[model samples]
Target: MSILADVGAFALKLVLILALVGAIVTLVARGARSRGDDQPAPLEIRALHEQLRERAERIRLETASPAQRKALRKTLKRKRKDEDKAPGGQKERPRAFVLDFEGDLRASAVSALREEISALLLVAGSGDEIVLRLESPGGMVHGYGLAASQLARIGKRGIRLTVTVDKVAASGGYMMACVADRIVAAPFAVIGSIGVVMQMPNFHRLLKRKEIDFELLTAGEHKRTLTLFGENSDAARSKALEELEDTHTLFKDFIRDHRPQLDVDTVANGEHWFGTRAAELKLVDELMTSDDYLMQRMETHDLFGVRLRQPRPLMQRLAERVSMAVQRVREAALLRA
Candidate 1:
């Protein structure tokens, strides 16, 4: 089986990744990008309020009967206001800021996530909320550790952070989620794998059969733990395992610090658990999809999604218009593009 294929408890993770993908598509539709508009603003951030309202209207018109549509149009024309009022006739509305993180082996979203977090912190004060719509199956340790540090900045600023995982947030992904004030996962979403793993295919045997020699040189005694083309030594394998166990300890300590209620020893086995089992193990705080969480918050909070986007250059855009159409279509099913 491919290393990426599941053979254990992870097989039980019936991840509703499609829901996460839909939320991400909505996030992109409401993000800081335009379609060939070339506004010269370098970047633009659209308020999700207007986008959501527009989408809602589109949905209503498409799904409602003619008489219902007429009634809806009339209501839209009328001036509307929040029903909740403060003591002095002011509206008491809490703000909800959203950001999306679609992770890969390299944790590619870290840069954009940092910028979005910075932007949100500039205007978001106390009583505000930030939700990260996140999905990642874990990745390189350093990449995710840095990504987790970016989220840590949000906590240091005293902002409430809610990380919603509609799919999988395992390994390094869980490292980032542990820093959140709340973690919400959909049923059957994959979680945990609160440990370290490393693997590589050794081609030394093949090379030997072909009468080829592979040399690996390292100054430090344990710098090169394993090699793809060189024979592996017992000392090297032992060192590699030792390092992984050490990282596992660090991983457990980090989660324990954030979620003291969790019995780290019981769950930190490089084994992923389905969302229901995760909540039972205290790996996630709640069992609900990201869309459900956001919709519930939208009623009282001014729910907005922040995305730090870079505009494509003219030449690149031209080339992309030629090539990216196929690529985009291919990646449509991915959680993020």
Candidate 2:
């Protein structure tokens, strides 16, 4: 009888372990929403008006009476209403929505940007403007291509789209910037690189010396041009360059399609330029930092910031903690070395 009781206890423990694992799996699955699904991706939006109002209150406190401060708080609390009435009872100004994108080689921010675009499209009006604070050094062709397409959604909806680059927006990143109705960059910001580029290390000779073989097979023509392992031919190399040229042509055409005034031939040399040079090349429309643009806009327009992201699941959250731990270990090791 005691042995049977022990067996039942073990079974109960196993059931609880299984239930915990299932819960973690479900939570991760919830975050991976498909584009076709009717359910919107989990989004988080924040309005900067509260902070702005606090600043406004501080500015007025020196001369404002207790009654005036109370009235100011009341007026600021109705933040989302169309617009505040000025002295003559006329509307103050329109609204501006701001979003940020600091991209990686994979353009991973597109997932969050896509959801934000969807949310804004549902309510953005003609007078409303959307500003994207973009900073990227560029990356994979297809990855940034999709990111640019996501930005294009703003212009498609007839909402004014402004892209401000405080640092760099080169190569694949510039592909995205060109889609904006107006492009602004800081004085020293890096821009352009309107061409295609690819580089990879070849290990075929190293494998041959070690008496190892790397085999690759494909069923289509030009399927495996200029591979990392295997003897490459002149024909394969030529094909690769041809493909790059074709991609470059497509990149230039897209820029011209959007900004017809740009001299595509002069700038499509796979070169980068500073903000002032870029403006002269017509690669940018204005030279200004994102912070300055926001401050100037605040005079007549209400500023709001939006950010959307999936709530991290428990195990996923744990994985982040583990990653931080690993980074700390690596830093310690480096310090000792």
Candidate 3:
């Protein structure tokens, strides 16, 4: 009888262990299924849609007095189903929209800008317009030039584009704002500085003093005008200067074609000025903040803050979490051991 009791106890313990393991496996499988369905939408995206809806609902409910609530209910009830649809079965066009560039100058921003332009064109008709709120100290010449090109795409589509500078738009930053149909600015917003520059440091003298020599070979006469460790030549310097001048000329021409009214010579002096001064020089159309422009349009048209789709995968998030958990477990086991 004691032997039989021991056997039963062992069987019960095994069943209990199996049950716990099965529960854990089932939970992991269900969790995996759920995570698979919830594909990660975007990386570093502001939860704008969820936020807007929640905020609006809170405001509607919390601020309403009894009388106001009754009136709101009546109004809401009176709202027709047809009102939700756009005129003539078409989507209702937004009255005014925003194009905000609150990031630093980089190739990534240029890609986002390109996507934003595509989205704008999708929603905005030929008669529609855009207000680009630009703020940047500047960035790489090629990168910002590409970003500027994205803005130009809007104008090419026959859509009027307005640029408002509130913080600053210097060098390549100015290159982008200048492409707008009309440029506006706040009184103190930094504007202008139309120029191009390139810098390369040569440490050949230091290297020679240290008795360290380096050899570089190239096929083209202008393949490498400047080097980090090689001696620089007068001819190379002259060639570099010539190239810079040509690039500056192209920049001036681009501005000239866009704003024919401005004297490229005057604005191309690589000097930045305040908004009021810029307006005097016709660098800006008017002195107005983008906020004012948006507020004025809000009553007449719907406003939207445009942004690019987030680009992150669920697998990445899951892998990161799993790796973190594994590391923690390993660390804890190591501590015990």
Candidate 4:
């Protein structure tokens, strides 16, 4: 064969070998990291599972008393030797439950937190502590009201709930944090925006200039609020103001009720405060990050992050797997190219 042909063949062989190796590595890596039918269970979950298994084994091995042991010995001769020993005789394991609030300070976060808190109650009894790692930028009125109530559940259950804010937990976010028995924030974390706001913009002048008019009809005197077009009546404006005031009052009451020490008038002016300043104003109890708390707690108890099992439909799981496979193929192609 010509030298050029030989070189071309060798190059092709080398490319093939490299491609195969790359594919194998990617496949193995993906397999290792693949989200199992049950969310790629975290280390904490696996630990919990192992602990439960050990506990069951121990219970099976443990005999109630000498009479129970003798009874078992008489009933089952082969089980005598094993009955005296405790199966997997490990020490009583420490238990810690996690309450994670991760996402926008909206209804989704609220719902998830609510479920998490409920689950915590299920696994945690009295004297157990909860570490709530909260990261939110605040959200709508009713949305955060529900979220705050979720945290309140922990308090109602007599669970010592500790909130850690590593990021901004302003407005509604702070509302949720305030319900905690103790609040912790990072030095630079934006902790509080203890107020409420209603935003409205009117385009009446623009519509009138364009020779457009909007006619809104309603039965109740103040049913329809100030609108975006066709001019707003003084009564409608008053109604809108009244609505804002009512919401603001509710917001203030929520804060006052949660943190009684907070001076409502000072913090209810629709202003935000940083971590250190907030601590002074009694918005947050102290400045501490989630990581620090986790590290400190790790020495005593295994930190288990508990989340509700989100049951995905079979079709959705299949679709996700197919999409992931396509992505892997695309990545492989890009690397080869």
Best by lDDT: 2
lDDT of 3 by residue, 1-337 (tens): 6655655565566556655765676688678878876764332324333355456666886799988888876665456344655378576545455777854756456766776778668878765668788888886878888888899888888888888888898888888988998888899888888988788777999999999989999998889887889998899889989989998999899889888999889889889899889889988888888777666655555666676665555455555655675566556545544
For 70-118, candidate 1 gives per-residue lDDT tens digits of 8887776562442323257675678989888999999977977877787
TM-score, model 3 to reference? 0.69
lDDT head-to-head 1 vs 2, winner: 2
TM-score of each: 0.75, 0.76, 0.69, 0.65
lDDT by residue for model 2 (252-287), tens: 998899889998989889899999999998999999
Candidate 4 lDDT tens digits, 254-324: 87887898887988787877889888988888777787776676667766777655555444665565567
Relative to the unseen true structure, what is the C-alpha lDDT of residue 249 in candidate 2, on a scale of 0 to 100?
Answer: 90
- Superposed Cα deviation of residue 168, candidate 4 (Å): 0.7
**Candidate with the larger TM-score of 1 and 2:** 2
Ranking by TM-score: 2, 1, 3, 4
Which window of 10 residues has the lowest lDDT sum in candidate 4?
40-49
Span of ten consecutive residues with least summed lDDT in model 2? 78-87
Error of 1 at 159 (Å): 0.3
After TM-score superposition, the amount by which residue 86's alpha carbon in candidate 1 deviates from its true location, in angstroms, is 11
| Steric clashes per prediction | 0, 0, 0, 1
